[model samples]
Target chain A: MLLEVSAEKRFGNFLLDAEFALDCKRCGIFGPSGSGKSTLVHMLAGLLKPDRGKISIAGTPVFDAARGINIPPEKRRVGLVFQHSHLFPNMSVQANLYYGWRRTRKSDRKIGPGALTTALNLDHLLKRDVNSLSGGERRRVAVGRTLLACPRLILLDEPLTGLDAELKSQIMPYLKKVFTEFDVPMLFISHSLQEMRLMTDEVLIPENGCCRKRMSTEELARSSMTSVPRSYVNLLTLRRPQAHNDIWIYSWGDEKLRLIEPGEPGDNLFELGASDITLFKRHPEATSARNILPCKVVEIFGSGGRVGVELEGGGGRLVSQIVHESVRELDIQNGSELFAVIKASAFRKIC
Target chain B: MLLSPQDMQAVWLSIKVATTATLVTAPFGFGIAYFFSFARMPGKYLLECLVNLPLVLPPVVVGYLLLLFFGQSGFAGPLLKFFDLRIIFTLTGAVIASAVVGFPLLVRAIRIGMDNIDIHYIQAARTLGAGRLDTLLTIILPLSGRAILAGMTLMFARSLGEFGATIILAGNIPGVTQTIPLAIYDYANTPDGDRMAMSLCLVSIALSFAVLLASEALARSFRKGSADAP
Candidate 1:
């Protein structure tokens, strides 16, 4: 879906003037709180009218102030999942899930209720009241409810904002599964870099009520390394875990790495901080760390006092964060070979 | 049990008038409450003031205005004449008076209910492909059911004890427009009629107590229904 928007809206002291055009299926609007991320979502969904501008979805003009055209939200076919699951209090889980499906035109109903229930794992809770569900279950049902509408584009406005860490992890996989299976275009909005990396490929950064930048999700994450407290977070997709006595062994591409934490079978995502990987000029013997690999320095580029060493080894790539002084002492440069040491316990499973 | 045939007629007429007034006012009450709670039209505060004027003003003053409006030379006089309807000194006039007098209470209750509902629910329904009227009927209306019931109960109780308005508009006819309060008023005015007046007062209390109890029971059931799985 191609979403084109050029709109301006003012709420007293705050004015949101956004102009952008995106054609990606998975796009994100990333910004801090009160930076007008939600305002843009509301405009796209037709819940909040833009003061003066034009908005078109897939070449259809949904809103054009100059042309005197403004479609209502129900006719726009732009579904939204709010932060809190605002499921109808009077409806059962089944009723809430099908509320949109029942209203969608037969020709437009691409996602069926049965398939949605199975995908969202909501079949067991169909007979339960909405208030009885847990936070993660409510979010799953909310996503299911929106998907059943078969919208042209779905907007998720900080859908996991208030959830705890464990609940957030539980809901992310379902979100990924739905977008993949249904092939529906979505605009994911959130402030967390981790969520953006996991859910979207490209991101639009909104600041001070305007979208100032548009870049790849990886570029955005890397740029934040200098400012974010965590330095840099390396996302690793590991699979085929085997129990190795006291530890778990996982395969990364063609290389096997031992981890202290055990993971379930199949593909698992883990976050290893760039600061956690210690670089050595030569292979160090008798170290307590379990994982050590000889890697070639592919690139060395960063700002501020910290430098990022891009490593290519273990049949994959990893970035190690180190101080500038260390870079000089180790004489690190492009195409230089080094040993990267990491403790097995440093790997944190995200999902 | 302690009254004449005319007293019995008055007792039955009170129930009929109160029931009719409450039923007729319910839909309009809900509509006005919705408008107040959600609509963003200009001059809304003015409309609100008009709707709530009867609540603060004296009921006798409300009846007097209705009397003139439906009188021969009043604003609605030509309209009533066109429809060949008589509103003054009739049971219909009693119902109109009761409805107008109790309207503010009913609207207040429903508006509170609607206001308490989260705005996101309405937005969610709209994005989920439900139109304006569809959302109102399916979401807003059902969510505020208890509030509507409470409003109706308040209106019904108010209509049962509606004295000043009913007396002025429908008059104190013994077997026609006289309700329980009007009957009690008559007995209190006559010589050696204290027993009849006291008995009618007791009946009024019992009727009001019954309405309150019924509303409580209904509200409890509504709560349980929403909590249980379908």
Candidate 2:
């Protein structure tokens, strides 16, 4: 199904001028915090009215402010799993499931209880009170309840936010299974790139209050095509050079120069890492490494058994992490006279 | 001591009043709560304030207000007259008073319960293709049992102890219009019936205690559910 949303809304100082069509079965709505991702979902689900726009899913008109046509959430056939799963407290897992079942009109023409509940592993929890279920289990039941309604489209609004990482990992497979098993298309919202990787193939990144662009997660993650992966972006190693659109240009070797896109013109940042590099880093002695001045090894930092070496590259700061074993075997020290490797391929196409 | 016919009449009347008030207002009360909690409506704030008015209004004023409307030649008097009905100073009038006083409490408790509910479930249900009323009847209602039950208890307690409004609108007519609270008031006014008044006092206290206990229990469970679900 193709879901379209074009709207204008303002929440206090936050303005939302977003428009996007999601064609993928599973797509991620990605953005930094307060990027209007949830606002977009709210508009889709009929929870919030847009000032102007038309939203249609598979040609069903969900919203059209100009025409004054706004479908109520239930009629829109858009299921939403919230950041917080709002299971009905008074009902048992079984009752909650049945609640969704009873609301469906068989004549409206799709799905059955047995298929949905069994798919979500809600059968065992059916008899249990919703209050007694664990967070993970409640989410499962909530998803089950929504699916049992047999919606045409599903929207998950940061559905895994309060979950611990382990819980998130544990539930990730079930979410994948639910997506595939239920045959329902979904819009998954996430702020973390790590989470976006596990959830969807298509990624829609929201910047400011609007969607900047949409692409495949792989394409999004690739260093050359996109700057999604931290390991992919180019890190400038020169002491100083010309600045362009907040990007700094640095010579890697005689021929290879890389661009470091640092966002807007005025913002300044200190200390960058090779892991933060989107593309490549290399150290060369050419008349080209001519710009590469003498450097100094500064410090090393890592977590959970990894090591990152800090260096002063020709008076400019650069960082590259090494395996603990590498640091030990290579005799790398605080003042080691090793080159801070820089590469040309490390430059990513930042849109 | 053996049960007296007066006590029996009062007990029966109390049940009748409480049951009728609950039966008539529950579906509407829950519906109002659901709407107030979830729906985007024009004049919703006005409606919310109206629904909650009784909670803050003195029961006597509420009774007085009902009397103004339901009394003979009053605003609604002619409408009920079409059916040969009279509300003032009758058992039905007592119910009207009880229900009015209890309604705000019932709706507030239920609304708060519903407000605490994540609209996600309903949204999920909608996507699942359930219609508006269907979601309300099934998921919303069943899921909010604790809050609704709490509302029910509050309504019953308020109705049982209802005096100011019941006395004003329905008046105290022993064995008919006189509920337990009214009965207690009448007996306690007489020198020889002090013991009877004390007995009624003990009964009201006990029932209120029972309702309070049930309220606490439901509240505890409500908290447990909130913690588990999100």
Candidate 3:
């Protein structure tokens, strides 16, 4: 879906002036609190009217101030999953899931209840009241309810922010599966960089009530290394896990990685901080870290006292952050060969 | 068995008038409550004050206003004449008086219920492709069902005990517009009629108690229905 929005709004003292045109299946509206990310979502979904602007989805104008055309939310065919599940307390899970589908035009309904219920794993809880479901279960049901509406563009307004670390991991896969299976375009909004990387390929950064930049998701993550307190986070998606006695071995591209955590048989995502990887000029004769890989430097970039070294090894690319003095001592440069040592505990399973 | 034929008529007439008044006022009350709870419009405070005027004013004062509005050579004189409907000193007049006196209580209960409903539910329904009317009927109505029942019960009880307004407008006729309170008024005024008046008072207490119990039971069922899905 292509979303085009150029709108301005003023709320008492804060002013929001955002203009952007994005065409991507998975887009992220990345911003801190009070940065107008939600305001943009609301305007696009037709819940909040823009003062003077035109917003179009897939080449059709949903809101045009010059033409006096402001489509109501129900007619916009843009679904939204709120931060809280906001499931109708009076409805059963089945009824809540089908509420949107029943209201949609017959011809416009592309997703069936049978497929959605199975995809969301809601068959067992269909007869249960919405209030009785757990937090993660409620979120899954909320996603199902929005997807069943067959919206052209789905806006997720920090859907996972309310969940804990464990529940966030549990619900991320379900969200990924539904979006990919249904092929619906989505704009994920959140303040979490990890969530942005997991859910979107491209991102729009808004700051202080203004849109600052638009770039690839990876680029945004890389550029944020210098500013974010956590530094750079290396996201790894490994597959085909095998139990190795006390530890688990997962295949990473052409190499295998040993970790203390066990992963599912199919695929699992893990996060390794750049600062966790120590680069050595020669192969380490002995070390307490579990995994050590021979890699060649692909790129070196960053500023200040810290620098990021992009390595092409261990079956894929990994970025390691080190001080400027270390870069000089190791003589790190493009095409430089080195061995990267990482502890097994450094790899945190995200999902 | 404890009363004459006239007393029995008064008992039945009280129930009829109260029931009719409650049933007639309920829909309008819900509509007005919904407006006050949700709708954004100009001059809303004025309308709110007008709707609540009967609550603070004496019931007799309300009856006098209604009498003037529906009386011959009054504001609605020509309209009533064209319809050829006589409201003065009739059963309908008694019902109108009861309804006017009880409307504020009904609206107040329902409005409080509506105010307590989270706005997100309405937004969720709207984004889910339900239109305005659909959201109101399917979501708002069912969610506020208990409150609506509570409001109806309060109005019914108030109507049963309405004395000042009915006597002023319906004139306490025998076997016609005289409800329980009007009949009690008659018995209390007559010499040596204290026992009959006391009996009617006991019956009033019993009726009010039954209304309260039935409403409580209905509210409990509503709660159970929401808690346990079908």
Candidate 4:
């Protein structure tokens, strides 16, 4: 395994106990706020010592509480891109990126600055002071700096939390490129399912303070509703439109779906949260919903008093959750034909 | 040409003593300040109080304490004799007395600078495989330049005017240990020495103004450098 951790820590009322082992080149830890996601990453990076248990990276035991072996953070060879992009205020962009480059051994250097600068589109930014860069620019530099360190593994903490839509779109492509080009394992932490899908194939979902499950992105898309809010349901593939600048148009069978924003690279799936969608027994006129797809009910699943009606329409599939009373009133059943009503803003694009 | 050869020697001695004291106190001050800023240990408050004792104590008492430690019959007598180094009533003693009096000011400035540094920078440095020393030399030291410079200047200024401590430990020696302040006191006590004292006073004012101006310029440049960073 490239990374192995079974650690427990307690902070007042909150307890963090996470255990996972992964050899995948790209893996993600997905959870909501206060899920102990950051705490888990910190432990793996050796910033915080686990009260008990062991953590190993690339076959080297970096921390073994029982054996009294704990390696310091500097020697752990795990790089982290902080949420705030903590670039050194005193150095230029070139200096900040090279700060780690100069420290790594020549034999360990898998990539050089010249190529990285070109790939990250950082040629014009190297000589500028870190303070002058925009939010998106700073994030790019932070990633470059961490990657140049020649670490065996990398950890990125919520890299897209605060960026505007424009900045997020600008930086996401570069980040995806880095994820694929780097030959080391990476542990990405995020609350956004779209970001997780874009970056990793496998994911560990943390709830409360423990990693409750580990699964692939495909499984997560198909069965993500267990831990997520009721609004989010199945993930469906969407074909990119030929030439749409602001809105992405995906045509299913004969139904056309229009999304507000562009999707990340390799993004073929769109999340239709059940709450954002409604079902109609007959085609209604004068509705604000931009997407009205004719679908056939394929399956019916229920939880509590809510009913999840899976529909296959326009060469795509999705689920719509409605109250049991509505299902009874509308007589929703398997093989029943219905129209799935989706707001243009409700479609969340994911890779 | 308003000053005599003896007056010139006094001015020169003051500069030498202040410069030496500032240089000597800098490394110790930085280390102590860095420790106080970052390290967590038992009785840290007590250690901080001990380091800052010179700031609140009387200068004469500080000199007396130095004398007791470095005197011929004091606790450090053996060590001093082993090195064949004389500190009591010598130029070196004056330098020591000035450094002792100015130590706290230096540390306070440095500690404030160190305190303002974000822990994230240090964490980032470590994750990038930069060790403690490496981070200190590259990140902390460069970023804390203004504070270090301010501390050194404050120490130098304090050392220039150190009088009570110098009188007790180094004594009033004309061409050796007598700095500007000690020389001024001597001239004030002697008859027909008012003119020389006035000239020295003007010279002292001019020197202090130059130091302050230089410090201001340095601080401004640091600000500009950060503002223009790209």
> Top DockQ: which candidate number?
4
TM-score of 1: 0.97
DockQ of each: 0.57, 0.40, 0.55, 0.59
Going through the candidates in order, the fraction of native interface contacts each one reproduces equals 0.70, 0.67, 0.63, 0.78
lDDT of 4 by residue, A1-351 (tens): 888888899999999988888889889998888999988988988899999999999899999999999888898889999988999888899999998899899998998888888889999999997898999899999999999998999999998889876687678778888768767578888987767777799999888998757999756754655445654455566665543776678755466678785654444556667767799999877798888888899988756556678889876778788878888889989999998888889976543
Top-scoring candidate (lDDT)? 1
Q: Which rank order by TM-score, best down to worst?
A: 3, 1, 4, 2
lDDT tens digits by residue: candidate 2, A180-243: 8767888889886656656688988888888647888745544222233244222333323456
Q: Give candidate 1 misplaced runs (Cα > 4 Å).
A: B224-230
Q: For model 4, what is the error of residue B47's alpha carbon versus the real structure, in angstroms, after optimal superposition?
A: 2.5
Which sequence of candidate numbers ranks them by lDDT, best first? 1, 3, 4, 2
Least well predicted 10-residue stretch by lDDT in candidate 4 chain A: A224-233
For all candidates, the clash counts are 0, 19, 0, 6
**Candidate 4: residue pairs that collide:** A127-B230, A128-B230, A129-B229, A129-B230, A252-A314, A253-A314
lDDT of 4 by residue, B95-136 (tens): 999998899999999999889888888899999988999989
Chain A of model 1 scored by TM-score: 0.97
Query: lDDT for model 2, on a 0 to 1 scale?
Result: 0.72
Give lDDT tens digits, candidate 3, residues A1-351.
398888787888877888888999999999888998988888888878888888899999999999999999999999999988788888899999999999999999999889878988899999998888999999999999999999999999999986899999999988999999999999999999999999999999988888747999999989989987888999999999888898888899998898899999888999999999999999898899889999999999997777999999968999999999998888889999999998988999999
Give residue A278's error in model 3 in angstroms. Answer: 0.9
lDDT string for model 1 (B41-73, tens) is 999999999999999999999999999999999
Please provide TM-scores, in order, for all candidate models, with all chains considered together: 0.97, 0.69, 0.97, 0.87
Worst 10 residues of 1 chain B by lDDT: B221-230
- The residue ranges of model 2 lying beyond 4 angstroms of the native Cα positions read A91-130, A138-150, A177-184, A223-229, A233-351, B2-4, B39-68, B79-82, B210-228
